[model samples]
Target: MPGRVQGKVAVITGGASGIGRATGFLFGEHGAIVVIADIDKEAAIETAKEINSLGALAIGVGLDVTKESDIKDVFESAAKEFGTISILVNSAGLNPRLPSLAGKTSEEIWDKVIDVNLKGTYLACKNVVDIMAKGGGGSIINLSSIMGMVGYNSVMSNGLSPYNPSKAGVLLLTKNLAVALAPKNIRVNCLNPGFVETPFTETLTSDAELYDNLVKLHPIGRFARPEEIAYCALFLASDESSFVTGAPLLVDGGYTAQ
Candidate 1:
């Protein structure tokens, strides 16, 4: 169990915080050489250092997933250092409530969310395919959301937020890549997590009224911990899930089931 991903190299975008950071720690604990890539350079480095202090091998790199060059550099550098890029966790994403979107036009908000959530995942997968094929196979774990499988409650959303659509796009992208890369032995899958207590959901979770309402949506009556989702990503990353591909594994606390 300790070395489930032994000797594999995993590059996780948005590894500075939230689900990404949790996944990084979990993968490292399982013996993967972790590459923490985040738009926040300082935070990424700090996370890497923390992981290293925990006796795991990790390197932090600044990455803006929206930039093709950044993705190229991270993949190339990781490959050069570790010799093979085996796991990719596309955790870099943006939601409508991101603080940076304050005062931005609706169009701008949509564009940014889509670019980071949907397009960023695409770029990472696109750049890593060849590398993985050369290494004889790998796993790609995309972070979709419950919204991808179901519409937002009309009371909470006007049905125009790009967040839902972007996640939905990830589902299809994962499937397409799974089929296309099947021959290469590369496995592609996604995780549709329900509301987890992460910075990404800060706006809603921090609101007492809103938080209670959201929790009620999940039959479990509570949100997930970051490690819960990380464990699912670990299963997909490890050979234990070799036969699973193009699957959207929902860690939604029965949110979608309802």
Candidate 2:
């Protein structure tokens, strides 16, 4: 039996950890040639090695999606290596919760978050359009969040969090690109996930009080698993979603239903 994405090449940014890493593994398992591009070179390589060991074709590359050269190089090289890139998962992103941004000022935090979360997505989408179009069309899955659709509660942040704004930008960007690139045969969509249990949320989840509060917001009584979200990405990447485009598929555990 052929896997859903058999023989297709999927280039995933932020493929070293969290949702990105899980998606890479799922894509590989389903027979796609995965390219794990991330800021952590070694982690990315390790991920690719693991996928290959599982009998999938994959390669890992260090990437800083904020840089156009990095995006160009990774996408082009992946196309060159795999013959063509038919799928792209712009999963690279930043949130105020990142420990690296701990001591940074508000301005610095805002800039960094927006750069990686929004601009990086823009750059990756811009660079991959040509390759996907040339390949006769492909699916692009951007990772947005429930925050992208609605404002966060005051308890989360005095409303100064750049995370929400950056993700909100991603939702609109997905829509714009979907409209502009439809004729080119490329399908663009975004996944607005709710809280997911991944390293990315370790900091907050480690605090029992905060974790409980956050979990209650979901209405499902818990956060999502990384693989659950990856399953959604799989559908978008596969031909089963041929008629889906310019959509924001919410896999947010009824968080937005309230």
Candidate 3:
């Protein structure tokens, strides 16, 4: 039998590593023509090659979601290569831990995080809406965080953290887009994951004490694996979620329940 998303096309940003990479692999396994779009061109290519090696149709495209030109080019290329886009996973993001944010003014950090995490999502969705609508509708999975729903603990951050608000923006964006596009049959939703063990969290997880503290926050007693999050994305992307839209599906191991 064919896979759940057989013959569909999926474009994933930040597809070079972590949750995005894992999602790319899963999407490919499910028979989607996967497009790995990332700023890390080489890694994206390698990921696409790996997917192809697994006997799946896949391609890699360089994308900087913060740039409109790059976003447009990625969709255009995917459309030209694989036809209409059926799924979009906006997984590209940045956190305050990025070395570039060190010593930067609060305004600078806020702008940077919001640009990549929030605005980038908006841009990708804006660019793909037409393609998906024209193709008879599709699914859009945005990556939000538990922080988007609740305030960060003091252990995570003392005052307002830019990452928190940026993710919150993503959740709202997902909702707004979902509502607007529901009439067109396009489903827009977001995944609010707890702390996940990804390259993006290496800085914090690398610190043994911090890692332990982080784990304690999640009632599940551990941080999530990338594949764990990928599975959630898979459900949202597949037809199994045909009735789900504008929802902030929490895969946070009960972190927000407390």
Question: What digit string (tens of lDDT, one per residue) describes model 2 on residues 1-258?
Answer: 999999999999999998999999999999999999999999999999998999999899999999999999988888888888999999998888889899999999999999999999999999999999989999999999999999997778988899999999999999999999989989999999999998889998999999999999998889999999999999999999988898999998999999
- For model 3, what is the C-alpha lDDT against the true structure? 0.93
lDDT of each: 0.95, 0.94, 0.93
Ranking by lDDT: 1, 2, 3
10 residues in a row with least lDDT, candidate 3: 152-161
RMSD of each: 0.8, 0.7, 1.0
| Candidate 3: tens digits of C-alpha lDDT, residues 1-258 | 888889999999999999999999999999999999999999999999999999999888788999999999989888887879999999998899877689998888889899999999999999999999989999999999998999888887867688988989999999999999999999999999999999999999999998998899999999999999999999999999999999999999889998
TM-score of each: 0.99, 0.99, 0.98
Worst 10 residues of 2 by lDDT: 152-161
